[model samples]
Target: MPGLLALVGGDEFKPGNEEQDRLMVAAAGAGPAYVVPTAAARQGPDQAVAHATEWFAGLGLALRELPVLRRSDAMKASLADEAGRGGFFYLSGGDPGLVAQVLRDSPVWRAMFGAWRAGAVLAGSSAGSMALCSHTLVRATWPNRFRRRAMEALGAVPHTAVLPHYDTFGHKWVESAREAAPDLTLLGIDERSAAVWHDGRWRAAGPGAITVAKGAKMTRFESGAEVKGLRQPARMLPGR
Candidate 1:
């Protein structure tokens, strides 16, 4: 069976996001939800874990922390083993480029794929969400302007790119993202909102909306709305 995947905008472990959190737990059934704070490691993994723990506790689900912070940690057999047993695996928000670099071709990442294929819910927020796409948009700041560049990602979803926090700074990056990769479909997800992949398509969940942009046409989808034409193509990253 194909596993469930959720790409969230941001503000994951806060209030007002209870509904989507519950839905994710429900998708996983009866098992602990693994929290991967690799992206937030630079800021502080402990804080991120604490927040996720409290948030999941409100939903009556256990949150397990997988502290795969560095590239070496990603190669640890112990971490990989723990990651393989989760019912729901959540990737917290932080630096998207760093997340992609640490997990790319790592043992822990391979374990995550195996676990998800065997029936686990895989969820990512902000940078986490961006790292899962075939192409990732890395934002840079100069003396007077901000720049958006495209980079290689895990390719869990092929020919696709995600812009998290769309209700805020994400919207501004949409056009730049399109210009960077015109052939790829761009998804702008609002903060506290999610776009979940299930039943062969993506569906909007949570309070905010999801915007799908292709070429010059852009469409918006609200909660419970199904987003069509996001199927995985033949150009998916190897071993995806």
Candidate 2:
């Protein structure tokens, strides 16, 4: 009944947490952890599998790749059975829009939610990480051209937008996020470092930091905060 969601920004998976990672590799009781790499590999599934394999190895867990992003009922049923039965679930970095469009309103997405509620460790990275909020900051590539809209996120964390590659990338994210969802908590996760979330508290680990941007008031925390005391601002884009 306990789950861990390790939402990574980007990093080479280095073996860590030997036992914990091993348990994750075993996928516990949730069958084999579902690896959803739909965001990437519109080109091919091998890329996604490569990424997942490396990530799991770094986490000290071994994973079997599902390698499919279909919204079919059979896939949904399989995912539901996995959640009801037992391991972990992971989403590799790629295109957030793709992930959303492919999995939106489908049984697979629904099953994921149920698994999370049942305490399934749902780890992800980059695009995968971005798609875990109620309001997500999709693409922030074109500086001033930054745009954002509401999509059906995983709804795991409400009133939040995950800003990955915070420190690694320049301050572009800061500007874009400020223009997009200025009032929400913009969790700027750095590379190598992760925001380990559980029991409503998020603690940063690894050799990096996390930035918490709430409107004009923004600050970075080496160790992230719990969901509580995380000031929720009004739902308005910046310059309101």
Candidate 3:
């Protein structure tokens, strides 16, 4: 079976999605799903753990924090185990840049790629979703008068960049993505919306839509669209 990928622009571990959660569980051969929250800048270790704890409780599922993610070695080891188990891996929303930095070239990130290739489900929202891209547009530089640097991203989906939080405050700067990676596909996920791919089709699930921008062509998909395995590369930049 094809692995499940829940790519949300941002905002997860909030409420609802019981049916979707059940569907994801079923997709993973009815095995227990792993609720891994990588996005969470405000909360500390304890708060982050507790937040996911409650979110999974509602679905009658257990949540485990890959604390190793905080450490390079431990994170890699944990991700290796996560891949071996063939269980679901859910990346919760927070800071996309931090998530990539924590997992870049680490064992956990390697395991994540392995799991995806092995047909294991990989789900994430907000920052988590952003990290899924080949080039993640992280909000490292706040772009204020005092801060004048662009955020660095961990490229997971090479040649493709992400435009996360398109419906949130981040929408204003999303256009700048073209300048970053002119030749790449832009996936703009909306809040409370999910971009799920399974069985060779991309299905939109939630109250919002997923916008794709390539050059000047911007299209929106509703709850149903067969976009699986489709290679939508980004538009090439000038002089590239």
For candidate 1, report its TM-score. Answer: 0.93
| Candidate 1 residue-wise lDDT, 49-156, digit = tens | 999988988898888798889999999998888878777889999888888889988889878866777778888999999988887788755541235778888778
Name model 3 segments beyond 4 Å from true: 16-20, 29-32, 74-79, 144-158, 227-240
- Winner on lDDT between 1 and 2 is 1
Task: For candidate 3, write residues 130-208 as lDDT tens digits.
Answer: 7766666754355441111234343434455556566775556555666656677777766767777666557777666
- Compare candidates 2 and 3 on TM-score and give the better one: 3
RMSD of 3: 5.0
How much is the lDDT of residue 118 in candidate 3? 62
- Candidate 2 Cα misplacement greater than 4 A, ranges: 12-30, 54-60, 70-75, 83-86, 140-152, 223-240
Which residue pairs collide in model 1, if any? none
TM-score of candidate 2 to 2 decimals: 0.77
Clashes counted in candidate 1 amount to: 0
In lDDT terms, how accurate is model 3? 0.60
Error of 2 at 40 (Å): 1.1
Q: Count the backbone clashes (under 3 Å) in each candidate.
A: 0, 7, 16
Candidate 1's C-alpha runs over 4 A off are 29-31, 140-146, 233-240
